[model samples]
Target: MANTAFMKPRAVSDALSAIVGKGPMPRTQVTKKLWDYIKKNKMQNPKNKRNIIPDEKLAKVLGSKKEISMFEMTKKVSNHLS
Candidate 1:
């Protein structure tokens, strides 16, 4: 069976809400919103798409990292979700 854990709604933190919007939303939706925000803001590194260079607002959710990998992004984001 497919894992449904990611589909379960979770409480979103204030920091995360700034990026993903108000949530009580599923992880999938949060990730989708994050991606939409990133794309809309053109945050992906030109040299390496795997790395994201976040803007001020995104930096808050990402803990102000200079750069972060796509894989690490999920991990970081998870911290902001309960």
Candidate 2:
């Protein structure tokens, strides 16, 4: 059975919304949209694909760090979801 928790819609912060779009959206959808933006912009680090090079809009969502891992991205993104 699918985990309903991940499918429940949640409020998204302004910063996150810039990357994932304005939402009351599910975490699954948020992740999907986020990945779509990332790939579209080619944000992944060349030598280290696990690292995401957050752009200006993404920087607001993930902070102004130089880079962050996919795992860290997930963790930080959750903070923007309520």
Candidate 3:
């Protein structure tokens, strides 16, 4: 049988809610939406490219930090989205 628990989609909350809207959205969708916002807002730090500089909305999800690495971003965002 399939592992339903692992496969189940997580809901958005806390910080993620600010960027992606309130949810029950899948993780894939959340990531997509976040990238969309990032691209739209130009939040990625131009110097580093791998780092994202949080704007007002992104700050909420990033624990009020001003910047985060792209790799760490996914893990951090997951915390707010469960």
Instruction: Output the number of the lDDT-best candidate.
Output: 2
Specify the poorest-scoring 10-residue window by lDDT in model 2.
57-66
Superposed by TM-score, candidate 1 places the C-alpha of residue 53 at a distance from the truth, in angstroms, of 0.1
**Model 1 residue pairs with clashes:** none
What value does the lDDT take at residue 14 in candidate 2? 95
Strongest candidate by TM-score: 2
Model 3 per-residue lDDT tens digits across residues 40-77: 99988889888998888888787766688989988888
Residue 80, candidate 1: alpha-carbon lDDT: 93
Candidate 1 lDDT score at position 61: 87
Question: How many clashing pairs does model 3 include?
Answer: 0
Kindly provide the TM-score of model 3 when superposed on the true structure, using C-alpha atoms: 0.81
Give candidate 1's error at residue 57 in angstroms.
0.9
Candidate 1 total steric clashes: 0
Which regions of candidate 1 are displaced past 4 Å?
none
Better of 1 and 2 by lDDT: 2
**lDDT by residue (tens digit), candidate 1, 29-65:** 9999999999899999999998999999888988885
lDDT tens readout by residue for model 2, 2-81: 99999999999999998888999999999999999999999999999999999899989888757999999999999999
Q: How accurate locally is residue 68 in candidate 1, as Cα lDDT from 0 to 100?
A: 94
